[model samples]
Target: MGDNTLALAGGNDKKWSDITSQESTDINTPVSFADTKVKNVIGYDNNTETNVRVATIEDYENLRDATNREFAYGVLYGDGATETMESIEDVYEYYRIENGGRGYPESNRGMRGCFVFNTENGNNLFFPIGATGYGQRRTEHAWYGETQLGAGRLQYAWRNEEYKKKDELGYRPLFLDVYRRPGAIYWVRTIPTNPTNKNKKYCFLDINYFTFDFSPGETEPTLGTGTSACFIRCVEEIP
Candidate 1:
């Protein structure tokens, strides 16, 4: 009659002994529960005050696989305000329709390949594979300089001092694909350290046929000069 006890017909109480004999012989044997059991475990959600489906190991594996695929293609999802790595084809279709049906151009399509460079202050930093150039003389100036204005810009953008140092030593990120264009020069955000005329020199990447020339100490051209028309490579942050 107690709440924990189960009563059968004729007011008889049932216990584990009564059900043990009825159970299949295979029940006692140790068998694999890979797919047959624990498919969808239900748990109560305190915040929503409802029952929610709990994620299993399989669910985590699927998510990790999907994320790897997204990272490979640099696919992004979400509205303009927010973005995440999911629903690749849907976002691509939306982007294609929004951009006058032209989608992305071939030369600049490499920009779509983005990978997480690092995480700082709870935000993820991503660097695109391709670079973009500002029109006219604007492209000549390094966005960050050795002057007071550009002093902390590199640290602010990249956040990790060690990675910046590695970058200065021509360290290429493993996630980035080999740039299609060889002998291409691009402007990096890091400012070179020059005791004399600090504002005049800025760090630029002289990408050679097989390797990167990332020496920040070497001087290139003065800022705002028309001769240094280097493509601008940018790093973006996402929360």
Candidate 2:
């Protein structure tokens, strides 16, 4: 089958006629085909479906093996309230399994892991591969703050003590995340700036040290006056 075609027994989408035979089977179970595999691993959701497992290639730049007992945490930022580190790990592992327990997918192709970040100006930032690729680029930290966006494992970002200088900054981050290879341990990039900085980016800043605010207007206002409005652009993934 092609790469897009998920090798599921019943396939990803099953038409009504494919399963509405009205057979007196277990209705509660997701209508999937039974497997005769040797080792059936139970998923967190009590799912018995044999996940398609793929092997992870251990390279100095891509995948790193982890301890079976030890757990890795992540500092999540861009994810909304829904996706957490534990949930991300669950999805990560699920894909690994779907690829035959190998963390690497068989049809590996490089695509920019970018996202669209709208700027105050009439432009857009196509940040391909947000932190994941950035983490892979940096060589400083072994674990970036991307793990907290995992599945529902833990949420420590809301804690005041975890965040540094909370009184001044207004957010508290109490956890760390492994950015991963093809990733980084700690991925810190900078906010885009105008030509005023001469293209020198303000990357890898300690977010705990900055303050953020968004003030909009009909047109850009001046820096210091009653009607004058200024927007200081800053972003942090931690609490």
Candidate 3:
């Protein structure tokens, strides 16, 4: 018989409809079909049929291997890059071009330079070394702060003092060549509770130090003044 064809008892050829006919006798007990194999089991959910399969040992191994793999630092990522980063100079050159030649002495510190690090969940997170002035946290409202920054994990770390000691959090440089200067001020995605003037205070990080204000040294930036703006590094996940 052909692989696609089926034969029933007494050597009679039968179609799928013939086998499932209402007149057919029902077999309640388990009946094994010889030489039958299936890659996935059929199931139903929410009135919908689905194909379900358990993970094989190879699947688990592949996941473990992917999780354990380390990311090569200074590697060029994103669209149309052909080479791997070979040196710190290469990283700096890439940074300069991306930053429009703005460097440390400029107000755009760390804004344009891109770096990547791996997370515990095996995601490659790409982020800038500096903050951007475009999406400045305009309100001191804590909820607004969290929603605007869109970095809940980072905000939690900043509030709980996790960044100071946790190297895996990506606040500190994972690779030696990835430059992040000490004492550089950056904004956190949180606004602390201050019943006195909640609208005036916003949180920021001075690398190892943490505080709230409109600017680094000042109590608050003049409302409508852009001085409250600080580097806001948003993270992107690479597939």
lDDT of 1: 0.30
Weakest 10 consecutive residues, lDDT, candidate 2?
Answer: 213-222
Where does model 2 exceed 4 Å of error?
1-90, 93-161, 172-194, 198-239
Q: In angstroms, give how far residue 127 of model 2 lies from its true place.
A: 7.2
Q: Quote model 1's TM-score.
A: 0.24
Q: Which is superior by lDDT, 2 or 3? A: 3
- Tens-place lDDT per residue, model 1, 12-87, is 7753223221112232231221222211212211222222232322332233344323222343332332434344
Superposition error at 64 for model 2 (Å): 31
What is model 2's C-alpha RMSD? 23.7
Misplaced by over 4 Å in model 3 are: 1-76, 85-90, 93-120, 130-185, 194-202, 205-228, 233-239
TM-score of 2: 0.19
Model 2 C-alpha lDDT per residue in residues 1-239, reported as the tens digit of each score: 01122233434653222322112223222122232322333332333434332111111011112222121232323322244434443323222224444233332222222222223333332222222233111111112132222211122121212324437344334222211122211111112232454344322211110112111111111121111111111222122
Candidate 3 structure quality by residue, lDDT tens digits, 25-141: 222221221222233212211343333333222332243355444433222332324555445443333322323322222211123222323456556533233222122322221
> How displaced is residue 213 in candidate 3, in Å?
20
